[model samples]
Target: MVNLKLKLSEKANYLAFLIVFVSLGLASQSILAEEVHEPAEQIAPHQEQFEAGKFVIEHVSDAFEWHILTYKQHHISIPLPIILYSNNSGLNIFWSSKFEHGHASYHNFRIEEEGEHAGKIVELNEAGAVVGLPIDLSITKTVAGIFISVFILIFIFLKVAKSATSSTGRAPTGIQNLLEPIILFIRDEVALPTLGKDKSERFLPYLLTLFFFILIENLVGLIPIFPFGANVTGNIGVTMVLALFTFVITTFSGNKHYWKEIYNPDVPWWLKYPLPLMPIVELTGVFTKPFVLMVRLFANMMAGHMIVTVFVSLIFIFGQIGGPALGGAVSPVSIAFSVFILLLDVLVSFIQAYVFTLLSALYFGMATSDHH
Candidate 1:
């Protein structure tokens, strides 16, 4: 019965993962096929527009401010610190609001409204044409989100640790109780199985950290308000860094046998001779493994966020085109779909964290495995 229960649990997890992936990917088709309508030749200077594509993209993209809501053309957002350095401006430190929600320029540096540099800080020449770029070390929305998520992870784990240490023999309680199963799951099911008992303990700490960090960030991004919804895990840059860490650890952990398998495996001489085809393929696999890790997490998390935003945007799009009545009619349906996706995203958050950690553990095991 215990074994049967475990099998069922594993099957359920996979089923949920497939559901989230397929549903989110299919729902995002509308967003991928969205048409960007160009502006008229002569348009009003202060004209308002509701571009669904921009709406969805802006929500997923990083920003200098934490936008709460926009009411009556008054943007309500928490401005993050803007730390910039440039040849012309030297070092300018100020609030992102000094740019006034990208409406004004500060110190001749402004967030580009359009063109190739859209959504980026650019330095302007005397003629107002873009001339240079600044080294931006600002605490943007995504950066802030990362900081928040890291803080939450540290706080929760520290408390859990303290609780476990204080009562050595007693049953786990509170946060420790909540998280103990997950920790054990990583150990018994993921690490121990893939990496074996010898090295699993050695790498368990990193695997736990990786799993929780990605999991927390993924869940936090689903929160649609204040300090939480920065889309940190959805960002390709963040995923790339996470994947690079796994790659670095795997490469350094590789023993002589691992490299030997890559360079000159126990295969046909023809495969490794002349053009060194097998070696080339094996070398390519080294790079592609991490690349796949990066793209998979980024694409999956990004699709979830984008699909939810697209559903919510539908209400506004209908409202604009057919006024309040049409929008009011669509609001319930749109929100229902958004809520459904948000729930799926929660499941995906766990699945992605598990998948990344599992793959990483497998790589580490292969790298450190002894030639028996």
Candidate 2:
């Protein structure tokens, strides 16, 4: 009996040791896996300087150079032209690479990293007060994006025109085939219905340009790739310019009736006699119409870009905290959401273009209406 008891005790001791050994082995394996997968160099800096909001805002905002991606300690970027016109320097033109990614200054000019003039070119005096402000006509990332979109537009339209002339009534082919229906859709569904056949004919060119320009910019901004991804339409300046064009066209197209409608609105006699309330309200609307256009486009496009960028940033944030395994686990969820937003943004791009065009056409129609 004593021998049997000793044998059983020996077996139990061996079993306990085996279990401890297996647990230790599994734990070591996990640690090794994490060490192997964690990208220490890439994530460490980001973790040190990680301000989630700042990271997100920077990605959405315009930059002097086009930042493509980063690997290790290297940043792959394309430096754009930094064209500046200053009182002292006249025309100072150079590639943005001279700034060494905003580290070094050149020719008494530097890219402002903070304050109201952040991301702008400002010339400082010896005491550091801004003395000479340069007119920055630089081909910034946004400008480069605009140039790319314009080139695409010119290329596509030229091809479409050539096809229209050369095909000689044959069915449209290639890009022409795809875009013809869209163009026709714009004319038939949007232009004719809003501006009437005659007015639509008069304003079709402008409306078409407006529609396609916004559509193309929105699509390009969504790409997040080189020479294409820029928040041009999302920029308030760009949207304001577009709105200004609509405002100017509407103002020019306004006939006597359109003016009379605002200045001497057909309202209750009391409303006009005492206060000109109707006219005042109508006048406010004239300006407000364009303001709404500018805000709507800028806000919508910017929001979409921000959301996608934020989701992408999450992967890095997780990696910084729990190493690559946690980051890898979160990536699938993050990417799925981003892809869904991107698809939604695609539809929004078209809708926004259509809405802007439709409203512009409607405004034109109202201005040109003879019945009023």
Please give, for residues 291-363, the per-residue lDDT of candidate 1 as tens digits: 9999999999999999999999999899989999999999999999999999999999999999999999999
Find the candidate with the highest lDDT and give its number: 1
Tens digit per residue, CA lDDT, model 2, 230-286: 998888877887788789999999999999999998888999987889999999999
lDDT of 1 at 248: 93
- TM-scores, all candidates, are 0.86, 0.85
| Sequence-dependent TM-score of model 1 | 0.86
CA lDDT, every prediction?
A: 0.79, 0.76
